[model samples]
Target: MGSYIGKTPTELEMAGNEDEEDALGFKLTVLRDAMIHLRVQFLHFQSFYEKEGLENIGNDLKAMKIILMVVQNKIEELKSIIPEYLEIKNIGMVKQKIEDFDLVVTEIVLEMKEFERDNFLMEKVEKLINKLNPFDVPNLETLDQELSPNEMMKTIMSKSAKKQQDKMNKETIQNDVT
Candidate 1:
């Protein structure tokens, strides 16, 4: 495994000016780290509960852990998409595609947040959490093909622009010849 000496990949990507937003980012990182530590503690607690024959509670904890893992994986997947997106020179051409991607990702993040905050589902999840079983939701291995910059260029770019540019070039060449 490659060892990073300083910032993690996300931190490296997120480096910014030391401004008000930067302060907020620092605070967010602190909160995030605290939440992660609490999650680890919960995992240990769940293990203890399982050993004590409190299978239902253990299962609930396992289910929660699985949800956390899925969210984290989704976050990483989205992060990986950013550089590919920024590398595109013809960003204006793929404006609609970019908007679509943003919309989908925002909805996904909102759904997950709502899932976490859902008080109505707490009772149901407690009862059915045991049935959820095995702490691995499927990874998003197959993201939308159009989410790829190369794929978007190939499939979604407006051919009209190119055709227009070609026409202009042809007219220019003919004018020069005359």
Candidate 2:
């Protein structure tokens, strides 16, 4: 055979190993960067949630203030009514004013109930945000050491299957009850 001036088989094998390691390192870097981006997005969502909740509260407060003024005006009108001069017309006017006051009060009560429901929903969203906090994610080193991509995929698939099974079970139970 002609004299080879190139790397030997051992050197070539080592070079292949180095390339593999470099590729793995690059992939790890990319993963780290992606995680950082995800964290930033989570933070943005949290800020938006808080801002939106505050604005909703402010609007609700303004609505309440307006309702309060309406109720106050109705009260003043009732106070001005002279019971000593009770006539058919005055009595009818008083009844009309009372009905209007009742309607306003009913509307305020309904709005309060709606506000309470919205608060409950916001609380649920807050809990979800807490659960999805990116800072709670396992460190990259620990994650890499503990689970390979295949293992992670298996875990996710198993969880999904369990959830689907649970949903089917619930449906069956409901059907039997019905």
Candidate 3:
């Protein structure tokens, strides 16, 4: 079992800008946590599949389903950030979406790959990811920047728009039953 938790994530490129560095640190922090979460999830599923036989690993499959749903919601939230992605133009919504997607994707993609046989889906995801420009996503450092009043207000809209906090809480458990 290889570990996904590698050296601490750092924006080695941002050594030039202190402000950028700070924001990058926050982003990387979020990425790190998400990575760890996904790693644990994958490990759990792998074990479950092995023990129960992949054909009967319903519990493990359900867990993946849950993660996918949450991650999809998160992607929707982050998509709000880049106008290039979708119809929503609200900066807050976009930031929230980005954060949400970041949270889920960092954790699940590597693990999910074990189950996926499709190359097209991976291509689309890669495209969307490449389109992202980090500046559009907000962080505490971004809010701290001094700016014109109008600029501040436009930015204010994004202050509260992340999407992960909107996930559905499923109390019902999935059990194999006829």
lDDT (Cα, tens digit) per residue for candidate 3, span 52-140? 76577767767765755554554553344244323223434435536545654553455355455532233333333433333444454
Give the alpha carbon lDDT tens digit for every residue of 48-99 in model 2: 5567854545544454445444444544444354243242222333333334
lDDT of 3 at 122: 30
How much lDDT does candidate 3 score?
A: 0.46
lDDT of each: 0.42, 0.44, 0.46
Residue 75 lDDT (model 1): 41
Ranking by TM-score: 3, 2, 1
Judging by TM-score against the true structure, name the best candidate.
3
Worst 10 residues of 3 by lDDT: 169-178
RMSD in Å for all candidates: 19.2, 29.9, 15.3
Q: Rank by lDDT, descending?
A: 3, 2, 1
Give the Å error, residue 58, model 2.
21
Clash count of each predicted structure:
0, 0, 8
